[model samples]
Target: MSNELPTVALVRLLEGARYEVMPTASVVDAVGEHVPPSVTVTVTAAPGKGLEATLSTATTLARAGWPVVPHLAARMLTGRGELQEVVARLAEAGVTAAFVPGGDADPPAGDYDCALDLLRDLATMEHPFTQVGITGYPESHPTIDDDVTVQAMWDKRAYATHIVSNMTFDAEHLGTWCERVRRRRVELPLLVGVPGPVERTKLLGMATKIGVGESLRFLRKQKSVFARIAAPGFSSDRFVSRVAALSANPALGIAGLHVFTFNQVGVVETWRQGMLARAREERVHPTGRGGHQDG
Candidate 1:
């Protein structure tokens, strides 16, 4: 809670943060123009755009010399054959990491029902991705129970390298969730997800375009986040600082950040740079604040 702790944590997180963007038409260009090769770029897979779009964007980014991590939605793949093809393509593109989510597809598109199922299948493949990330929900899921989500992470531990937590504005909840994950013995490091500096209207529009289910899920489960985003002069600076403070406890295994850019790569990159600069500045000249400081 000391000023030094959060200032240092914020610098660490910002230095190694990864940007997650939807596979929209302008996303590749946005990332190429705004993001550097140092920051990893993650592409999302949505039912509306299909898995192909996700792969295409990832491959393109990889080819452009960026570290790319693609989301392979379990429900999007037909079976192992399709999964194999997907892996082969990523391998060809030199992508070494991936994130697998159960996906929002209703009645699932194939053999795998959950992320665990796809992860299990991936384990059988020869030389699959070196790093696999699974979703973690800090807040209650719209459909799944809170306990079930934690258990799901436990069940997928063998197959996943880390956990990318779902975005939440509640820093308290996020900190508690990290403690809960540690308590359950899910030792995989966590990449806390947070929204980038995106406009509320733009974010909402993109969410709606992705899928009605996803939009509904966001509206229903992230009401607080929505309210925060809609507020005038909304910024993630304070939220990220609070989340970063958790890193002071090594037991939490707060790896870094996973920024949901919502395809607003330019603004997000600028915001990140500004935050990192401020954190570095604070680290050098201690403000002497005893407790945590909110943005």
Candidate 2:
């Protein structure tokens, strides 16, 4: 592939891609006008709003003809029955994908404690979902140590079909983390997380309120996050370019991107279309054989 392939492939990955949405009151309406029927929008589990809110929102989106992936926070499940109900609900709606994570609820809501346990349960249940995703930490999770996260990834490898990395502005950190995953032989395809253009104040406030601890710590450790946050609105060009440059090898198995829209659906949609248009004008062609340039 040529030097331009990385950016081109990155744009291809962004096309008709997945964007995450929080299940707030205005979320559905916010996404209604902007998100197309073909794109997948993963509804996040909010501790304050409850898992029902997340699943309900996801099911609604799925019914409306959009492919939806809802966050099934393990802490929210009470037992096999609740899991079965959720599974049945998804099947009824024809939703085929989900993102499972150990939610940040203090004193977990029920029997399940972590994602692994819930994944085990899901494996045993007869469910409609074929694509199940687990979380990955690039700059290290704020609550868990790095080593534990590595082992957890290895353990969850059997249950998870893909890994959606938590949001991070440090491209180098993501590069190193992906390399480590390769060394460990965790073969799950990666979905790099990037936040779309959003208001600085709203972004910070949401990040803090959502308990994405790494976002706050990353802001302090990596100046890039702060720089973007300090700006009028966040633009993913710099962050996406650096990460794509570092992950230019197909061997890295980065399947696509996962944008943390944070319900900024309209702004994110505009940004994505602009990036795709720019890539086309630049003629960032990639040879079919070496789709990714040498990393």
Candidate 3:
């Protein structure tokens, strides 16, 4: 494929991208101030604040006219009753999408142990959500093996509408993982997870406090990931351009980007706008070089 194909694809992907924010105190205001209502915002569930934080933030965003998708952590709920209530709450708030992940809570807070368990129950209920997403790992999960993660996706395929890959910096790993998913026949469309223009110090601090086992462990294990983020001239624009070519393959099922903003909503939004503007310019002008200049 010519260089323009990926640049064109990057433009389309950025245009439809969604932002993921933690359920922080200032998140709603920050998102409201920076992100336009046209963009979809997803609220993350954390063990420290519990599910309520995610739901409340999501409801607030929804009421304010931004499309919202709340993460429903399986291990956070006590049982079916709690799940029902949560679903009812989201329905009342007009939330149309949900992303289910096996939570970080050690010892399992309730009857659910993994996302598939919660997804199974969700399938049985007349839930209000029109779209449901499950996690996909481009790199090996900190705990689960590659085969196990792939099998988990296959098992949950009946319930999930799409797959949101975990944050990854390696474009080669991402491309290989996409091929693996297709070879295994887990056909759900993917929203590639990419970190926004987050500050390294802030991101590390928040990750520690949030206590997400997978994220923290992944960070600890991959020292190079930290190095890259902490590197002087780091910009997600370069990473996105490297992987943007994969989206051109229909068989890969690359839907769009799911940007992990880490509550840096304003900065992330600025970066998104800059990238969109640049990608569009490249598309229109036909620079002939596949890659975009780092900002």
Comparing 2 with 3 on lDDT, the higher-scoring candidate is 3
TM-score per model over all chains? 0.92, 0.86, 0.92
Tell me the TM-score of model 1. 0.92
Clashes of each: 0, 0, 0
The local distance difference test score of each candidate is 0.85, 0.78, 0.86
Clashes of 3: 0
lDDT of 3: 0.86
TM-score of 2: 0.86
Give lDDT for model 2: 0.78
Q: Mark the regions of model 1 whose C-alpha exceeds 4 Å error after superposition.
A: 1-4, 208-224, 232-234, 290-295
User: Root-mean-square deviation of each candidate, in angstroms?
Assistant: 2.6, 4.8, 2.7
Task: Give the range where candidate 2 is weakest over 10 consecutive residues by summed lDDT.
Answer: 286-295
For candidate 3, report its TM-score: 0.92
Q: Report the C-alpha lDDT of model 2 over 149-230, residue by residue, as the tens digit.
A: 9899999999989999887777777887898998999989999888776766666665665446545443454345546545
